[model samples]
Target: MKLKCLVIDDDPMICDLVKHFCSKLEEIEYCLSANTGNDGLQVLSQQKFDVLLLDYHLPDMTGQSILEIRSQNIPVIMITSEKDFAALAFDYDEIVDFLVKPLHFDRFKKAINRVHHGDSNSKSILQDDNDICYIKDGNKYVKVNYNDIHFLRSEENYVAFVLHDKTILSLIPLKNVEALLPSHFKRVHRSFIVNLNKVEKTTLEEITIGSRQIPISQKYKKEFFEILNNKLL
Candidate 1:
């Protein structure tokens, strides 16, 4: 399948060069460019793209900051002049490859190949080939092990990932977050998704995880109980 792409870079020339490189390949359907992070995000929110070519430093924010709020589904190839940012960039799960500045068509082709093949040059520190995630906590991304997550709660437009010590709130719909989660996480109610491994007590009405009592709605009660019954000793 031909991939649609977006190049988000501060340098206009870099963007043009990438667009040119993309035109040379039949694998790339079309490539669009945005000069800053905000413009890129605005475009992303309006349209769906198969891959993102993100620059490390934009005038509005660092590329890492953008990764915090963006959709998890898009594969990203990080572009930067700084080799030092590679380690930091690879910490995000979306990143497929790290490209140094002054791009070459051959190197760019390799990055595109990785995206097509569903491969990354490095494993994400956030996921680390396991059930781990980095949740946005203020200005930083805090590492949270999946087992530590008692449950996820929906609050308005945000979803709160509740761990034992604290809760991290992200500006994403609960359903969108739900798709990225592992199978053990069950949607018990419209507002809640509880980790079965962390569940301490379960009743026909609610599930207890630590001090939190999550309601079980009629729509989900049967399947939730069925899973619990299968595990009962």
Candidate 2:
């Protein structure tokens, strides 16, 4: 699904940079722009957008003023040169994330992704007793059920999800994939993530699921055992 995005920034260079960053993402389409908060509000009133890339400081008015006067429905990622506004950004329910200037591409993508999911922090998008997630397969995206997944193993730039019948690979990093997974999934090692509910047994050094064993590295062993112990009791 493509998101309609509006940019509100006074700097022409920042506007161009935003457009350049968004042009590369399949999820967001650059829809509109405004140089000031009042202009932004006028554009907002005339059209609709799924997300807003708002600059904190505007010539006529601040981004906060616009949010206060408008509907809190749209997800906003506030971009600011000043780090002091981070605490203030969260006061508005519409603001999903606060990004400082000189935005990293990966960080920008993650912010856009959060907006794509409607800022959902649910365990997973469950349907018909199945938990599902999307994986990019070439140009097409595929839906994979969490129940079918046995474990996730990191492979250089990619992470592979081993299933009972088939394995699914994604180009996303292990850390990013971990954030997408539900609470029932645990990262017991830097290179391994396992479904806690699928575990048949657990040892200090490894976790056994079905007939396969997944190694638990020392990096995460302490925290892993703490969570597992609580679940056991």
Candidate 3:
């Protein structure tokens, strides 16, 4: 399968070079390029990608910040000139490899190979089937089907995925999980992520999911209502 990839860098030349190199590889395909982290997030929000080539420094946000926000199974290769951040990058389980700037084509190819070969130490929580998510709870990874999920409630450090039968709490933040869920899941409030498929009804003030009623954020009310209306239509 051709790996769909995104290259995010402030340097135009580096982006072009990476794009060119990826074009030569039969197994890799360049999906898009972004000059800033914010723009990169916009692309990620709209499309699914297999790999990401991220620069450490960007005008709006650092690559690390973006990774923190959206932690999916997709491998993220850090492309930067800075050598000091290698250790820090390794700390992030999502970062597959670190590639220093003025990158050698051989090394770049090898990094892609690592992702293609599934050599990353961190096992992705995302599975091939869209209907289920495997979340780490204590010493075990619990599989929760998407249909079972009613809504996700975020605590300070952790989020609670409230299912129809029970709730599964994980150490990972809610925003990261939110990015991986399909469009059916919506952020009704800053603290709540609701499954549109499981939604029973919605009033002007609250959304009913199964037996639970979750409030909608005032700031997101208009957009939230629009999505709900569109879904029903």
Candidate 2: 10-residue stretch with minimal lDDT? 121-130
Per-residue error (Å), model 1, residue 178? 0.4
Cα lDDT of model 3 overall?
0.77
Question: What does candidate 2's lDDT look like per residue over 1-233, in tens digits?
Answer: 79999899999888888888898999986657889888888888888899999998889988888888865369888888875555455656677765678776766776788888864431122111126454554444445778788899899867888888877676767886787677788999888999887888888888998888889988889988888789879
Tens digit of per-residue lDDT, candidate 1, span 87-158: 567556677676788788876886787677664322221232245565655445566778889899999877
Candidates by TM-score, descending order? 2, 1, 3
> Ten consecutive residues with minimal summed lDDT in candidate 3?
120-129
Structural similarity to truth (TM-score) of each candidate: 0.54, 0.56, 0.51
Compare the candidates by TM-score and give the number of the best one.
Answer: 2
* Ranking of all candidate structures by their lDDT, best first: 1, 3, 2
What would the TM-score be for candidate 3 when compared with the true structure?
Answer: 0.51
Best of the candidates, lDDT: 1
